[model samples]
Target: MRKRARQESAFLNIPYDRRYESLYLAFIASLCAFGLRPRATIEIPSTKRRLERIIELIQGCRYSFHDLSRVQLDRNSPTTPRFNMPFELGLAVDWALGANPEHGWFVFESRAHRPEKSLSDLNGTDPHVHDGTAHGVLRGLTNALTRKIHDPNLAELDSIYRDLSKAARKIKESRDGSLFEARPFQDLAVLARQLAEERISSLRS
Candidate 1:
């Protein structure tokens, strides 16, 4: 039963910060649009052991997306580069090779060949570059998951993002809070799923 669920879900491993908010939203929207359920550690409550929870998510989801774009140093802190994204990507790669070679994952980057400079061990592997934009992320995601999802094209993905953004704004305005907050994020996922269903229905009609 657990294996089945894992096969049906896709785990999202991206930087959890305001700078990545738009890309994150675009990823979620694109996944939902193509009928894939997106899961992330953010869905877990803060009270739990986060690392353990993240591992659990990685183990439970057959498909994972690791965005290695934000490996650079933070503007506020000149010396300290963020390593969480690559760290989790490493974990996922290890798990796939050790536990299940069939488990598939994609490495995402903002610029071409950037991952090679930061994580040279992944030299032979290719990452989908998003150019640090919402549209780019959507296109990268679509191309990466081409085996599982039909191509929605950039125009269709843009349409979905626009619709989802409008719905997300309504939710934020109604709640008067940050959409990335736990509850609001959950609501946004629900709304994305609803919108995806509506899209499918329209296509069928």
Candidate 2:
């Protein structure tokens, strides 16, 4: 008589430092739904190992879903501090999916083959436009998808864009929206310099 866990609540209730609560919860549900009643009760660490191996394979480009072992649903372990496999595998997946440089296994389909463009393209008449719509869109999409899907490498961008988009949307919905002139080039220049000097120097190694 095991009651089903609410997906969103289960997702949020996992420990803060533990990253892959999203994936683990989903995996547990999937296992239970498949009738593995006895297996789903196991601790996160055991299941985490399998996910880690799969991510490693993905990172090395040598793995597929078929390569992993099926986790039993009814297996329960009394392990505490829960496994961080989901978070770790998520990082590997993020690495596999690329970060600042586009070299990940999972690439976005949105800009697969399109030529990069500037903001002026949308408003050719604006001689002082700094067209950064492309960068903005790409940044937003990458952040949202990666964070929501548990891809770790690109997770920071989520809060960055969440704040950026919130401001942008608020401005857009205002009566003086037309006063929002594009300064994309200036923003890009600042971003480039910030990335090269300030940000790059701060990386973990």
Candidate 3:
């Protein structure tokens, strides 16, 4: 039973394309943002190095549009604040996921209890225009890959994920919010991998 559980958990960490109507929309949106025409499927490498490369490319492109340096945490707030760049990128991811829930390409859990941030919260004194930009970037990147794979359904899933992430960010930013407890997706991936390794080791022991 433990082994099965561990296998399931590990499987979650392995990224795969999803199947949903919104996913296709996300592909189109992403292509538009990246200035690329839609293809049958976005090509992505199956190796870890390739995955990291894709993520890095997205992260690099994401920082070009948003200025995260001035992101301010509410004073007297206990929860650690999300920097602007990461925050914006996160929002993009949620929106992309939300846009298409049917696509199976996105593997992250969009429905989990999230940090309680909403669009209103993030739209503080300054205009949160970059929220859309970040969203666009995510769409663009997802499209770039999905087009190669011939899956258009992931677009909507990416949209939804971005929307949920925004909500989660607002919740996490709040004093009573559990944002601080939230781990970076990369960190969570690492932890999950380690947990799986440990679980496997225990069986052998």
**For this target, which candidate reaches the highest TM-score against the unseen true structure?**
1
Q: What would the TM-score be for candidate 2 when compared with the true structure?
A: 0.20
**Please, what are the lDDT tens digits per residue for candidate 1 over residues 1-205?**
9878887678888888767878888988887776667888778887899999989888888789999898877779467888888888888999999988877989999999887789999999989999999989988877887643444667777777888887877776877746666677677777777767666553223
Clashes of 2: 16
Q: For each candidate, what TM-score against the reference?
A: 0.89, 0.20, 0.23
CA lDDT of each prediction against the hidden true structure: 0.81, 0.28, 0.32
Question: Of the candidates shown, which would achieve the greatest lDDT relative to the real structure?
Answer: 1
Instruction: Supply the global lDDT for candidate 2.
Output: 0.28
Question: lDDT by residue for model 2 over 96-199, one digit each (tens)?
Answer: 35641222221121222221231112222211111223233334333323323223222333333333334444444553433122232123223323332322
As for lDDT, the candidate ahead, 1 or 2, is 1
Q: What is the lDDT of residue 156 in candidate 2?
A: 39
Off by over 4 Å in 1: 148-151, 174-177, 201-205
